[model samples]
Target: MNPARRTTITSAAVLAVTGGLLTTTAAPASAATTCTSPVFKRQFFANTTFSGTPKKTDCDTTIDQNWGTSAPTSGLPSNNFGVRWSVTRDFGSGGPFSLAVSGLDGIRVYVDGVRKIDLWKNTSTTVSKTVNVTIPSGSHALRVDYVNWTGSAKVKFAYTPRTSATVDTVKPLVPTGTSVSYDAATGKAKLTWSKNKEMDLAGYRVYRRLKGTSFGSTPLTTTTGTSYTDTPPPTGETYYYEIRAYDKADNVSGGTADQGVTTVDRTGPAAPTGLSAHGDLDGMVLGWDAVSGAVGYEVFEKDAATGSYTLLKSLTGTSYLHYVGHNETLHTYVVRSLDALGNPGPYSAPVTSDGIDRTAPPAPFDLAVSTDSGDVRVNWKTPEEHTRDELDNYGRFTVYRSVGSTLGADAERLDCDYSTTLDSANDVYSFGCVDPTWAYATTYTYAVTFTDWQGNESAPSETVTVTTADGLPPAPVTGLTATPRADGVLLRWNASTDADIDHYWAARGVRQADGSFKATDPCTRSTTDPLTALCIGIPDGETAAYAVYAVDKWGNASEWTIVDATELTITPGEPIGADSGALWGGGGWTMPGQGGNVQWHCEGAVCADVTEYRVSRWNTETQTYDLLGTVAPKDGVYYQSYTDATMPLGSISYYRVVGVLSDGTETVAAHPWQIRPDLV
Candidate 1:
């Protein structure tokens, strides 16, 4: 007999079916499964078919280790001998597993009484047999039989997990006796349970949810240890926890009973008390008494007029290190205490440092001065970012007039806005001041400087000398009148009284309630002269008001001479021929947002009398024509075109056109047939 015959259980042989009597398959590992072996019960037989096992009987973890050239027993025959090995193992889920056997002669394997591999023969040398077997989830039995009536006696059997599925009916034994302990201060809970006694016990999967919420599908964590700890539930929420036991084959037991635990807040420390501040050399020092339960102290510096504060530092001790060298002259600060949970308490009373600001600001830059007519204007750009004052506030600017660029002790200081509040047009913090009282034809030099709230003044900025022009604004134009015309409102006004009067400013506005006007840009300025302006008309039948302003050579404008459009109104006659049609699919009625076109003829005298044509939709519900838009109103009987891009998709509407007159009146055109537009 060959001692090395047991080596016949090679990898290839372990996978090969010994005969056609069995099929070979294996189940793959899952998220919860691992390879495991179970104890096997074995009986040695005195003969291959002698019906009696008159020898040894024992239990082994697996049938993998084999005996080659070995006797069955000390009192039994070595040849014509046989052995039977059987074992039942619990698989977690339905899946496939590999079964294999290696022996000198006659080896057979069965799973749940279904033969999977057979090599029943007398062979001169050892051979191996392997087959794939599938079993349902849960407990299943495996048996291996061997018979030796030849020179060598050997046998070995084993199994490996496969990716295939099997019928697994046995669920894992449930874990019981679950309990929880929570630490309110830490917001953590510890869960404990009796460990499962399954032979294939893998570990536990933990789950948690708020007491009233459903358990989430995924486990919070998987642990082999019998206990687990969880933290940070929504601060005041009571959480329920459960556990499930799983086997090496991924067989999961039912969930354990839910245990609840509530988390709470650890109160924060009180505010730091007895806070005081005093000057130390050029800087300041702050002191505060220790706070109970305080893990640290936070110092905050007041930096703005908004009373907002910035956290300066955290300290373990009771004093703060304040710096006066970092552009600091005066500052206010407060202190607060924080607990181990990082909750901060209310701040202590604020204290101010004892120092006066005396630092002057930088000179304003990019100074520009110009003169127009009778006025002199000064403008300049400031630093992109304003520097904080001694009291941490920004300052405003001032203008000074002088006989020369260089300022003298007797230089005249102009009245300018002195506050640093931002100007609407100062996008870059540029400052501008106007001297409208300056006399025309006179020249003056101007300079600017910035002054702080503490009265500290900046150096004089670059100076500019400006020469004003000849005179003041001309007198307002009188006798302004507007005549209604077919095309627009014709405006006329008397020339200004001032001999140096320039052109007049003209404007057109829509009429408003309370005798007011909503100005518009429909008016066209007259390039011919200032005495006349054209208030253009709209084809939409809207009346426009008119006004004129006298302007002098110095750019000074006089009060407006206004005239309402109603003073020269016109009424147009009704349109003669009107029609609507869908432009695209030809019925000339397309849905809203789809293309549709309308056309009407300017028939009879209305062709020349009408100043404009309007298209409108008669609202079915309100019985009113909603003006759609304007159409080209020409002095001809030829058809005019208008488009309706907003016609309702599935609504019926009557459309018509009305001619507009110079007097702001309308004449309705002939109504068209009712039409409905739709996409379908």
Candidate 2:
């Protein structure tokens, strides 16, 4: 036979396609005696579909062939023919193999006589596929096939082995060189690597990690160029980087070793705020709100606006006291915050002062003392000598308490912020500090002096002494009386007989199961304030009872003495009808912690079943009623009363009584009572 006829006969003996794109079936074939490794049997068909019979066939040594814009073989068919080639060859070992097959039209592959891949279609582009297969450990039939439908006829079939699917299976013969550089001023890192010695190298990817954190997901950047500049990160943070190379086929190589770069802290901290300057007799006192991340503060002073400010002092505190050692009168000052690296931030708004300060604060006087068993309260008013400017320049006071009447260096010292104490029970007009170490029945003397911001100390004030009370509790309250009132119940009790009793506590109980009373909170009233001796309007009914305890100066309390007032009742009516007229004036000890007493009475038939009563105290600041305490109706008593010693001080305190029924409702007072509080 001729070479063309032999080729056609060889091709016709291998494959016969009936329909579909290159669907193959076993055809007549004979064993090839001229076979070699990586060699394949080539077959050609007449139709675009791999149907009918092949026209030509031959043995091909390799699959890397480019047949130009022509038919693959000349016989009976035109340019459209679905062809396939196959050969039984040993794979040495089979784990993961990449089979690269591409051509102008279409291609497919078969392993061990089984179709393994199919890209069978008409096309002008090349296509490839990689698959992992096992062929035992030895010889297996390998097939690389293609067909030319139209256009340029080109095909390539090649492969390389890989250990696994997701790892790089190819290594370059030549190694690559890499370098890194960082700019401290800009905090930017630039990475450069030598080009990979691979013809198929596609690009390089850069990865970075913070100093102590793991490398993040995804690469920092991907580029075909050899160099890349990274976006600058936070200051003072050190970062590490690495790179990897990949081919156009997406097979990656092992990453290069990591490199590290430490970025410098080039940014300074924010400026300070709320700056204030006060001229003192000695110097100026400068203070401001603390800056968040500042290590220190820098003070700058300038004589004129045209000139730049010169650094004066560095302070670790938020405030600075500039001593007037020189006669620099017309001075302007600005403050700046400094980072740990000694970088100064933007300056504060400048403050200009006219003259030097040399005046010392006047002596603080009129120091009074209130003594308990273990503590002595030293209260003093703001000195009249404390002028407006002096108070503005006030830093703090150095308090001294000597055991005797004379002031001495061995006296105990303390520091104070404000000049008066508003929360003290005794005096709202004076600032007080407590000495918890004072002994009972002992005499103590105290003295106070004043100082300015520049440390100019005034002479000591006149000394005062106080004798502490002995540790003894007061007597129990007695002589109880109850009356029915319009709002609730009215109660009255005689003062405790004990001389040392400074206050009284009245406790009320709500009638519970089995004829027992569940006690509520105890209300307090000072005994030294005579207007609070007889409480008038309490918000309880016949179901409640009352008891009173006497408390002494040392916080000692006596046993509770119950007042049987269950028989009392109140009839709800107009406001201020009962217990409304307090004979004492409003300001003289007429407030909570220093004021009046109340008694509640309920007269309704349901009063016997009353649970508790809620008393409302007016918040002088908010002008709204706040629930002070809930008292149970006093059982078997005609009327009941309670004393309140402390609501919020520093304003007029108002009180109202409301009877609580079993249904969780109230019979409220017509209006709340009013009194002026004397304590903070």
Candidate 3:
């Protein structure tokens, strides 16, 4: 028999053995004695059987005599088994309990004649059956049956009970209540909620969903705090909040009733109204109505046409001043509100305003000059009214003059009040005056304008030109040249002078090969005195030129003086062969005109006079020219003896000389002269 085979015997068989079967009552006294076995059964079994006639098998070999037949029986027959009958019984309360039976090839159990478990077939060596049963907290009758055929007959049974108290039943707690309120000043919604309740309550989780949005269930917090505050809800947006309680035990409560709140975004600092912009000579002044609930306001201003708004000022008050340093016909203004939280409100509607003070005094648009007795007579119509409105009674026109770069400190106020009403509905005024302080040969710039009662002045009319007393000075002579010094050109020239000459201006223009000059603006000049000025260290190049001019105080400039520039070069005249008295009765000769300087010092017979040669010499030992003299300038084309006479007979000699120009510019003799004594 295999030791692995499992067989369980129930104690009911022992009870049956100890007390004779209550059903049959026909067993021997010894059979009625209690059988001492290692098996412990939890329940009773009776009338059980084995599949074969009672015989020795691995599982039933040790069975109690009461359960197995004492001798082998012919054809297997069913047998009955029982326990002492007791109809009054109960199992404990609150139980998930079960009863099981095993051992005989087949077996069954009953309590008070009601079948509880059935394993009646004899298919396997050991089989067991179990059933869930609930007893009423008392005792009850139990019965079983057994049979034997080809195998041993054995019986076993057990029972276990369970309770409901061990199961978990706790639930999450809900938020108690919610409160909503409004901030009248800010137009914002504020919300607060009550704390959750639970012994293991780890914290309350808050969730918010905007109106029309699916609720976001993600818990916001796990803290135990009960109060929460939500402020400044999104503008024009309604929000809802729900809170749930979570226990440390991982249990969660359903969400509380949602609190709905809406925020009004319309409440903002009022638009800046009643805007007034006043203009003066220096700038503009802007004023507007104060907006309610505005911690501060920002003013954005821009030119009326195609200009982007620029932040003019952020003022806690309602008034701002702008310096219209320059004339501006129209301007646009916008304002926005800023809150204490640093949040900015939407921009206010833009306000377009025409600059105030439209009255402009008539002034000369064109100025003309007449000369008499060395004085300049400046005449002009009163500045024409450039604007539509009439000049204020206090309005007056003034004229200013400047000579050759010299501006007059004082201006003459003209009584140009001769008013003429034109068909165009414009008031015209004219005036003329003579300036004895003007100088001859000088140019002058004149400006005219009107002044208002508030000291606000209109922009000066377009600048007008006038020549003071004739006999103008000649234009400044330019294109001066100087000796070359150390790779640079030194330039010096006489500064042009005019009777009214305010200053002399000097400029340099680099000349390109195409005869075009890159004119540079006045490089440097003395305005106070124009008699002397010098430019030094001009770069060395061809066709370069300089322009000098005299400038009048009025910005009139004299004609420019121009001249061509020059460049320097070095050259070696010609090359001569060594005087060896061989090939040409003395030495061979050749001239490499187009070739430039040689790369290496020439050796042997291939030497020549080189005027700045190309560096293309080859090494002879390497099967190339030891030193190829590509270019050789003639040393006078006829003065060859001086260069050739220095060569040694039957030996190669290399020759190189330093060539210098009259200007001290120097370069190496073109190509080194290489002389082969044999060639000579």
**Candidate number with greatest lDDT:** 1
Choose 2 or 3, whichever is better by lDDT: 2
lDDT, ranked from best to worst: 1, 2, 3
TM-score of each: 0.30, 0.25, 0.22
Displacement of residue 11 (Cα, Å) in model 2 is: 99
Kindly report which residue stretches of model 1 are placed more than 4 angstroms away from their true locations once superposed.
1-37, 164-188, 192-205, 214-219, 224-226, 232-236, 244-257, 264-680
Encode model 2's per-residue lDDT on 220-327: one tens digit a residue: 888999898985575678889888877655666667878789876757778888887766654677889888667799998876957788888998889887776436
- In model 3, where do residues sit more than 4 Å from their true spots? 1-264, 271-447, 450-481, 484-489, 493-569, 574-680
For candidate 1, the TM-score is 0.30
The residue-by-residue lDDT of candidate 1 on 1-680, one tens digit each, is: 21211111122122123311111222211122222446666666778973753365655665654455557544457688877777777665535567777878898888898888989999978788677766676688888888888686767777875531244435666788899998654567899998664544679999998866899899999999999998845376678898998766677889988898877655677777888776432346678999876878899999758799998999888987576643445688999988767888899988886544455656888888766545567788665434333225545677888665466778887886433434446434566778745665676788888786657798989888866676555666788888665335668888777876666777787656777645665344544454766554322345557877777767877766678664222222322122332111112232222334555555555456666777776564665678877865654335565656444443433566667767777664645422222212
Per-residue error for 401 in candidate 1, Å, reads 99
Go through the candidates in order and give the C-alpha RMSD of each one to the true structure: 32.9, 36.3, 43.0
Residue-by-residue lDDT tens digits, candidate 3, 1-680: 11212222222224324521112122321232221222212212223422222222122212233235422221213344222211223321212456766675555667667877776575446776678775443345554454544345555565544323343234444666676676535555555666442323467777778888867657544456766665645476778777776655555667788788776555555566777666643356666777666778888986666767889898788777675644556777877777655557777667665556544333446555555545555554542333323344455556666554444566444333333334333344445566645665667777766566555565666666666555545566654554333222334557555455556656567766876546663332322234333232222234457656666554556776655455332112223232222111122212111111112232223333223333222232343323222234343243222223222222223343333333554343333433221110
* lDDT (C-alpha, whole model) for all candidates: 0.64, 0.61, 0.48
lDDT of 3 at 36: 21
* Number of clashes recorded per candidate: 34, 50, 75
